[model samples]
Target: MIRHTVGRLVSTVVIALTLALFALPMLWLAAAPFDASPAITASLPQFTLDNFAAILDNPYALGSIRNSLIQGGGAAVLVVVLAALAAYALSRVRVPGRDLLLYLLLLLSSVVTGTAAMVPIFELATRLNLIDTHLGVILVVSGGLLPAAIFILKDFMDETPTSYEESARVFGASPLQILRDIVIPLVRPGLATIAVWALASVWGGFLFQFILLRDPDKAPGSVILYTLYTEGGSPKLDLISTFSLLYSLPVVLMYLFVSQRYGFRFHGGIKR
Candidate 1:
């Protein structure tokens, strides 16, 4: 009884420490935005709404957020739609070397990341007249994300019972119709997972957007956030902290909504 009590006490202390370590940064982020003279360390905030108003006054700040939503939303939609169709096809169609192809694509995508392949990607975008365009960023980010999205989604598609699809087919449902009515509903959790994943990726994406978009108006939050630093390489903590809070809200809200809806259990489909 003594040993068990000590062990439980130790575990509780360790867990508390871990939670504090994580919570402190969030507490600081929450506090510093309101602090008139925010610092690196968390402290009692001075309490002002002026930080937000100051952010609004910056010509590119709010516009950059809107641009981020456009780029992230577009990329996420493209990734989810394409990944679903590709994963469903690969799941249903018994093509030789299909698994190998999937593995190869996954491997290549991992090995040749956007950072590593940026030169060629930029060249391609330029030749295609895609530079300085939101579509270019969406297309590039979506392409980079597709293999992993497809790989993750394929397992969900595979776990789905084909009997439902067959039944829908017997009832005169076309392929697309059956997919729409049956397969999609079963794999919704996976789709939600992919949507969130894709959105997060594009939301934090800086390199492609920075390199492709020369227009200040087209810059996303990530790029704009980078500019919040002083010319001396020190950060403007007041602005950075405030912007960080605003920058993080959308993704957090999205994750919450999706979690409340489809959840992250990743069950793939209804069990028999």
Candidate 2:
């Protein structure tokens, strides 16, 4: 009895400490942005909106959010739509070595990261006259993400009842119409998952945007966030913290909205 009690007490203390360690930084992140003289270390905030005002005064800060939205939204739409079409086709079709092809594509994409293939990617973009274009970045990021998204959505498609599609077909529905009406509604959760994943991926992406976009005004929040640091290499905590808060707000709100609306339902088989 004594040993069990002591062990439980020790575990509780350890858990508490662990939670505090994680919570402190989050607490700091929430508070520091509002602090008038925010520092690198966490402390009680002397509440002020001056940090936000200061950030607003910068020419590039607020506009970066719009840029991030454009890039993130563009990539997410492409990934979700293309992935849904590809996944459904792959699931319905029984081509020779279909599984192997899917696996091979996924494996290759995983192995060859954006950083590793940037040189060729840059060359291709340059040759195609796509440099400094938002479309170029969207296309590049979407290409890298499609394999994984397709892989994920394919499972969801496979799990859906074929009876629904068959019924739709018997009712004189076309392939596209059946897909639009039956399969899509059923696989909405999967689509939402991929959309959120793709948005976050593109929103946080630094290298692709940095390399592809030459105009500073067109830079996404990820690239713009980099400039928050000073020439001395120390972060300008006031500006950095405030901008970080604004930068992260959209993604967080999106996640919360999706979660509440979709409730993560992949199939009717899975209960909420």
Candidate 3:
């Protein structure tokens, strides 16, 4: 018993140590934007908001902030809507090729790198006359996330009661109306989950926008971060750090707010 207890204690300590290693870097990065003085920037010291202010003051940096919101918001909206519809069909209907289609979606969701098909995607976009535009990036980001978003919502939809749809049908509800009223509400938590996920996913996208978007004015936040990173000669480390922190605020706050409510409970693979 003593040996077992010691082993458990050691395992707990190891996990805590591992978590601390990751947490410390994130914590330091969160604090980095608030340190602006030469001493603070160099030596690592107390917090200040000057870094944030500097980020705002830089016109190009400010544009990046706007770009982040637009891209993230657009991607989130697009993914959630399309995913919800696809998920509903996959979960509730017996459509032909559904399983094969789902397998393809799963494959897409697991894509490791965007660069593998970069040339093809760029060529297609050029043919569609959407090169170097926000729409181009938004579509790429949306399509990339669509599969996972669909899967998540599909799982949730499976967990939802089918009686709701049956009742709606009995009342002569049209399919579109049933989807808008019954389906959307029944799986709102899953939708919320997808919303949070889409925000985080698209916000981190770098390579798609980096290669596809040549217009500096239209580049997303991740691309801006890359540009800032590459311009090591005129280093804006403080602003970059500040922008990173600022960009992270929405998702963190959203999770915190939601966590206080229902909290996340995974009812995996449950079908009504």
Candidate 4:
């Protein structure tokens, strides 16, 4: 009885400590944005909106948020559309070595990351006149995310009963029509998952956007956040905190909205 009690006590303490470790940073992030003179540690805020005002005055701060929205939203749309199409095709069609090909693509994409292939990517982008372009960054991000998106979506596709498609076919529905009218509705949760995943991936991404876009005006929040530092290489915690709060809000709001709408429970498409 004593051993069991001790084990439970120890587990409770460990869990509390783990929660505190994660919670402290979030607490600071929420509090420090409003602090008149923010610090590394979380404390009661001096309670001023001046930090936000200062962010507005910075030339690149708000624009960077817009740029981030454009890149993240664009890449997300492109990835979801392409991934849905490819996943559906691979699910319905019995092409030789199709599973092998999907696995190979997923493996290659994981192995040859943007950072690893940045040199070749840069060269290709330069040759294609894609340097310093938002479209370039969006395309590159979408390409990198597509394989995994397809892999995930394929499972949802596989789980969907083909009876609906067969019924649509009897009505003389084309493959595209069946996909649009029948399959898509059933697999919407998977689509939502992919959209959220893709957006999150691009939202936090820094390396590709930083490398591809040279214009400060076109830089995303991730890239601009990196520049929030003093000449002596110290971080500008005040601006960083303020901008980080603003930068984080969009994705957080999106996640909340999606979660409320769909409820992420899934065993293939959506748990029923």
- Top candidate by lDDT: 1
What's model 2's overall lDDT? 0.91
Better of 2 and 3 by TM-score: 2
Candidate number achieving the greatest TM-score relative to the actual structure: 4
| Residue-wise C-alpha lDDT for candidate 2, range 62-122, written one tens digit per residue | 8889999999999999999999899999999899999999999999999999999999999
lDDT of 4 by residue, 169-190 (tens): 9989999999898888888888
The estimated TM-scores of all candidates read 0.95, 0.94, 0.87, 0.96
lDDT of 3 by residue, 165-227 (tens): 799899999878888987787676677778778887877778887877788888767777765
Superposed by TM-score, candidate 2 places the C-alpha of residue 166 at a distance from the truth, in angstroms, of: 0.7
Candidate-wise lDDT, in order = 0.92, 0.91, 0.77, 0.91
Pitting candidate 1 against candidate 2, the one with the higher TM-score is 1
Query: Which is the better candidate, 1 or 3, if ranked by TM-score?
Result: 1
Task: List candidate 3 stretches off by more than 4 Å.
Answer: 37-48, 108-113, 229-236, 268-272
Give me candidate 1's TM-score against the actual structure. Answer: 0.95
User: Could you arrange the candidates by lDDT from highest to lowest?
Assistant: 1, 4, 2, 3
The TM-score-based order of candidates, best leading, equals: 4, 1, 2, 3
Q: What is the C-alpha RMSD of each candidate to the true structure, in Å?
A: 1.4, 1.9, 3.0, 1.5
Residue pairs with backbone overlap in model 3: none
Clashes of each: 0, 0, 0, 0
